[model samples]
Target chain A: MQSTPPGLFRASWLVARKDLAIEFRTRTAFFSTLVFALLGLTIFFFAWDPTTVAAIDLAPGVLWAIFAFSGLLGLQRSFGVEQADRAMDALLAAPLDREAVYLGKAVANLLFVGGVQLVTIPALALFYNVPLAGIALPLAGVALLAAIGLVAVGTLFSSMAVNTRLAELLLPMLSLPFFLPIVVSASMTTARLLAGRPAAEAWPWLRILLAFDLVFGVACTLLFPFTVEE
Target chain B: MPQQPAGPVAASPDDPVVEAEALARQFGARRAVDGVSFVLRAGECLALFGPNGAGKTTLLRLLAGLLAPSSGHCRVAGLGIRDGKLARAHVGLVSHASMLYGALSARENVEFAAKLYGMPDPAGAARDALRSMRVLDRAEAPVRSLSRGLQQRVSIARAIVHSPHVLLCDEPYTGLDELGSAALTEALAERRDSGAALLLVTHNLGEGLALATQAAIMRRGSFVRHENRSGVDAGTYAMEYRELVTLDA
Candidate 1:
């Protein structure tokens, strides 16, 4: 005698909306991650001599490295929220597709990581004096692709790590390896695009990002149900 | 307090809402729930009483499809438990944990669940459930801000918002005060009257027996005594339960 449950995509959105609503109110993870990313950008700026490594050359690597680490902070808390009152059990018992749970969390993480990037990228550009006037659009496109890949894999590992005793340590340890390809591909593309190199030169790296997103996205969504319960 | 009907009750008493056949769950070498089986038809309530760590919670988890059984099978609302989407829509669960977002207001928490169940009017359902549980006054307050009893009330509201055909509750009386307990008792009676199948796990023998149509005393992963409530004397059930639990210990 119950109403039909929402469709998969709609259920996913509901989960996302719920997470976003909580995040909006608390803002603990989001704010902390953003601050850590901005702080990392600042430290990286002072660590290297501009004379030896040009800010433009150093900026892409620094940006992605900060993005990568900051992402772990957000991902670490993604499933951790559910552990508070065993809320994950409620979610697990729900009639929605498990994939919806994974996608919902992933979307929330993407936005969280992206929100940090939204603020941190401009901060990186400002601190390192990387010219953004000409390449803003392509750079953003690269960031979005890289984020999708990072979130897809990171969200999966986050779910796994959350159940462990050493979730904080486990998340970064398990995720960094998977994040390697994404960071490498993104930074390479960013470096080329920043150098005013032809867009054709970055095509291979972009393809790698695309391939990583496609392969891991589907694979992670499928594997998520296994990580949840017995 | 009888609630306004949340939804239409099952039309047939013979329709089984929950069924388990030889259900078993193991953790490493430990058999938490071993070869347990039961059937709960419409309007039936099964109150399970057991000592701590006797596998009562494990059995409930297996039935709810929260934990995959090591062996055997179960169905909820005539759908295989393995078919989660279809089975779970017909089920609701309340555990020791509130299973709520502490940051969200009470109303929002129930609304989230209603939306998940795809109720047509999530806000209205949440309102009615909260009102029924006597927590509507605190609907806008964050769950974390509420007292323990109030939190439990809100938890009940969330569980019943969809008017699930099967309700699985584990120690649902935890943190509730006397008034809260009475309210829960009434709610359970009303739900039973409305044809929802319930599996309640509790340590309170009196409270459990009062609402149970069928009762089971589980020990060491298996039921030592299970029978219809009418066949068991309420005065002696506590003594019997203690003896059974003591025998296992």
Candidate 2:
């Protein structure tokens, strides 16, 4: 019989790797997220007149909104496969820790959603003619931290919503409320960066994102077992 | 010939796999699992029998640490279900639902479970488990494409991947064909041989009688009768089970 290691991080990594491998093979999750994000960007680019509004002004809000919605798509599909085959019972039954499962899903969601953001950012820059040269690294960093918070709560709620009626509709309704703080902070920070504001000015939003990420991530890790239990 | 210990002989009285006292679960006004209590030792397969809504599933969930009791207390592997982190590692569950990822292959599903248990080399463990269940040939195939029987095999493989001490199965045989049932039976026997304490909730008396070393009958959130398999006949046990449930009404 195999024994679980005492460290929580190792278990979380394994879960993340497993989800990544599965996503790589199927491409179902990645492709849907990519298409959803691109479509959102396309609609926004055409909706407002470029002459009337500076594209840079709308860039941060549009980018984060697309990422948020796209991330939800990936998060929904992450657990969708587990629910389809009834594999959750098997996962719950394993001798491993529940915190491991939570962290695994969280890490997987971050990477999957982060991957979507990586793709969406360049596309948004190209379409809007905005220069991403200086802010790309910070933007990506902020996106990842914010994704952690969104995925943490989203993953927990998805487990519950998947078993209910109208899961597709229910998940967003349940998750969106919890996601407001993340969306606000991420958009505010990203907008300031895109507007060529000084780093010191954007630091407040960065701090909010950091604090939000830590509190929500830790809380979700603690609460996941209750949500997924039979 | 003397009866042999099926697997490892658990130490006596020092620890019980399961111990419950006045355990109960109430949903709204309804008492789903009410004032129930029992003890299960390692290397024992205890069959839980009841009609639908008889609270058999509820009791099984409570033991597995999947559901919390509204009143009273229960412990699994000396850990309380309320201690979700500690208790979950010692308890495992298999149910009518497969709980697998359709997009993932059988191997991936099992490997994912291994990883969740914090096992290193999840791929190696998954491969060995699938091979043991005779489903290794289809390990690379997506679960959505596998037959129901094969999917159940994957489910079984996934459950034991982490090697939990206590296994809780609720109607594991529900949609299985004869061959599938036979396969599941063999797999379960293997688990039992490993000294895992199994708590099974099933409507099939024959399967329960065949697998269980001990059996308990439940109705309306309580256990009315329980016995060792060698101590009762099938016909008599079923008749008594029906009588007990009806007696209360």
Candidate 3:
């Protein structure tokens, strides 16, 4: 008798878990992203004339810029990992729910991007000599929202890019257009929060980021099945 | 010994587990699968022989639901492959691609496949399948660390971890040496003996004919000839295939 396929949540969890297991084992993608983000920050540190520029003003954009670009490395690894042995063929051929695969992959990308951010945020704070003081929670909130948006579109484009011959060149070209809104909103929100502006001022950007997240999250989750389908 | 051409009636004792009726898949101005059809009974294996670009892999992909047929219908265990989940639930594929996570241990890779299929006992089933492929001793080794032949064995283990009712293989022995090839043949035989219907596409006449209950030679996306394996010996088949392939070329 044939076995039952896992439910959406379970299957998605399994996919995410499997990817995480492999990522943890190799740490190739994870550390590369971490190092890239740190390297970007170091460049931003020297590039910015902190004596003349407001550290708070420059730091937010620098942080988001680093996060956005470094996140691509993680997103690229999303489906690139599956290509190692064409393991994706097995995933596609299985009785798997395509959406489950997408959600799982997106979530896994979210975590990887999140991991890079977790370290990058504090490190950026230290490098730029900015204190989180009162806005750490909201800073993290903004980071989370921005990451959801990044992974939503990143996951979609990653699936598409990997199938194309120009995969390496194509992913950034494809995802950057969609990711700009998040980068802009994230940097804007972080700027306000870092500047000690009232929650009311940064609120709109957060809402925009949240909306971007929900819209792309649902759409990408639904559209991913077709993106990877043969 | 197998009897008669395997159309849709050979060994009707068990219902046909896989049925393809005039299945065709087209790509841009080309028809990759031009109206091929077959019925495979449980415990039956069909070894399809073809030259390069003969659509053998395309046909297997069509059945695996990786590609949809442009026309006609195909089903596994009475359910449509295009439909939600049933087709995938009963089918397993072992392609030339090992389809594994290189960073993952062999056991972990099989466990992942079992989990996707929602097996009742994923760990136990994974171990059992790995052991069956004779790679259980290396189960803890990362797949990348294993030899190509051992990796092939792990791929076989992963494909069969769920005990699928139907197996679709596309040149599974591409990188195997003699030992690897023997292990794969044994794995296919075990699946066949367990009443799983199999469709294997290969260029290895000796091995393909050895395990096939029915066999066919395909050219330009169509089956030119199909006959019972019982009466079709390898030497005659190799000669006929060479002549047909040359003429087509």
Candidate 4:
């Protein structure tokens, strides 16, 4: 009746393209996330007296904080879109691999959250007077690793929260606990990397971030079917 | 429309496209679908009528592969419901919800579905579906901007873009105006005439009675009455359906 279903990877790409196209056309998730990150940066900038604290000390926390919360905003919207008119019901009924849905959502969240950071990191660097010229490349590597863990767990939790009575309050509560470890590791590594510390010194923390990425990425992808089941 | 087929159709009965046996689905302490079974052959349209909490939705979901039966199994389009790929490929569902991306234009929404199913010419298929639904004039408009009636039309277009072997519609006529409802009736009739098996769940006896080759009434997760449409008296059945639907099981 139908052509053979595409491989899991190809199916995921289709789903990812759908989400990306929606986000691009509507700009709802994209602008909301960008604005949230920018607002958080401004508040933190004005709340603290830059004269008393050095930008190097402030830059690490500020960067990850912006990344995490803005990512939460994007993750929330990712599933929120599915809730409109129960669009998710149609998606679940489709014959594609269940894992493809999880992977597609994770990838979309990664790109959205990643896009916000790509802009915010540079802006924060300019405002905080932190010298990121030499380390921008390496710092990006750390951010990418940390993002994988956040998007993986966030996508799973968002799926769970949307089914609950109070999704607005529930998603952050369910996801924040999982997000803590990655944020901590990323912040510490970013702090060291910015301080001109040798790459070897930050390797241990990077390993922890890498492990979190691997563990949850695989676990969440496999667990998605159970969570999505009717 | 003819009367009921008289008995359960077998799994491989002369090209039986839909076959279910002892299908039961339980949710916590509630048995949503209890030991139900049926079969639908090509060109058959089975209209399911029931009250709220009668498990009609659950039954349709089970057949559409949207929900898994807890105890029994069924085959759709010659593949088990658990066979997500081939089973889903052969089915299309139109529910109260539009199940469309509100931000995307009507044409874009159907095209996305076509592409999702690996159709080679998504654009042309989308155009054909929209034209059939008579919303081709507004094809460029976003679904959110359209009226509820028009949105339902788009939903129908999206569901049938693949021309699936089985069409599952759960209250597809809900929220439609008089004209909209009439349009839906015609659309559904056309879909049935295309040789697709249909399982339409609704509270409207008149609408249900009109399109079904066989009609079934469900109560508390089981079918209490199923008869051939040709034998059913609409005026008398409507009166009985109203009374029976209001009574607590």
Candidate whose TM-score is highest: 1
Which is better, 2 or 4, measured by lDDT? Answer: 4
Candidate 3 C-alpha lDDT tens digits along A77-116: 8999888778888998887788988999988999998899
C-alpha lDDT (0 to 100) for residue A33 of candidate 2: 90
For each candidate, the DockQ is 0.61, 0.47, 0.51, 0.40
Worst window of 10 by summed lDDT in candidate 4 chain A: A1-10
Off by over 4 Å in 3: B1-14
Off by over 4 Å in 2: A177-185, A223-226, B1-9, B13-15, B84-87, B118-125, B242-249
lDDT of 3 by residue, B206-227 (tens): 8898899999999999999988
Best by lDDT: 1
> How far off is each candidate at the interface, as Cα RMSD in Å?
4.0, 7.1, 7.3, 7.6
lDDT digits (tens) for residues B52-100 of candidate 1: 9999999988877889899999988778888657678778889999999
lDDT of 4 by residue, A89-205 (tens): 777776678899889888988998889888898889877878888897998899899999999999999998888888888888988889888988999999999888988989999
**Could you report the Cα RMSD, in angstroms, for every candidate shown?**
2.1, 4.1, 3.8, 4.0
How do all the candidates rank in terms of lDDT, highest first? 1, 3, 4, 2
**lDDT by residue (tens digit), candidate 4, B79-180:** 887865657767788998999999889998998777666666778778888887888999999889999989999998888777777889999998788877
Better of 2 and 3 by DockQ: 3
Tell me the docking grade of candidate 2: acceptable
lDDT of 2 by residue, A1-230 (tens): 33544357776776678778878879988999999999999999889698888888888888877777787788887777667655655555444477877888888888888788888889999999999988989888888888888898898888778888888888888888888888888889888888888999889998988898888888888998778864
Better of 1 and 4 by TM-score: 1
Candidate 4 or 1, higher DockQ: 1
Q: Tell me how many clashing residue pairs each candidate has.
A: 0, 9, 0, 2
- Measured with C-alpha atoms, the lDDT of residue B80 in candidate 4 is 88
Candidate that beats the other on TM-score, 1 or 3, i.e. the better one: 1
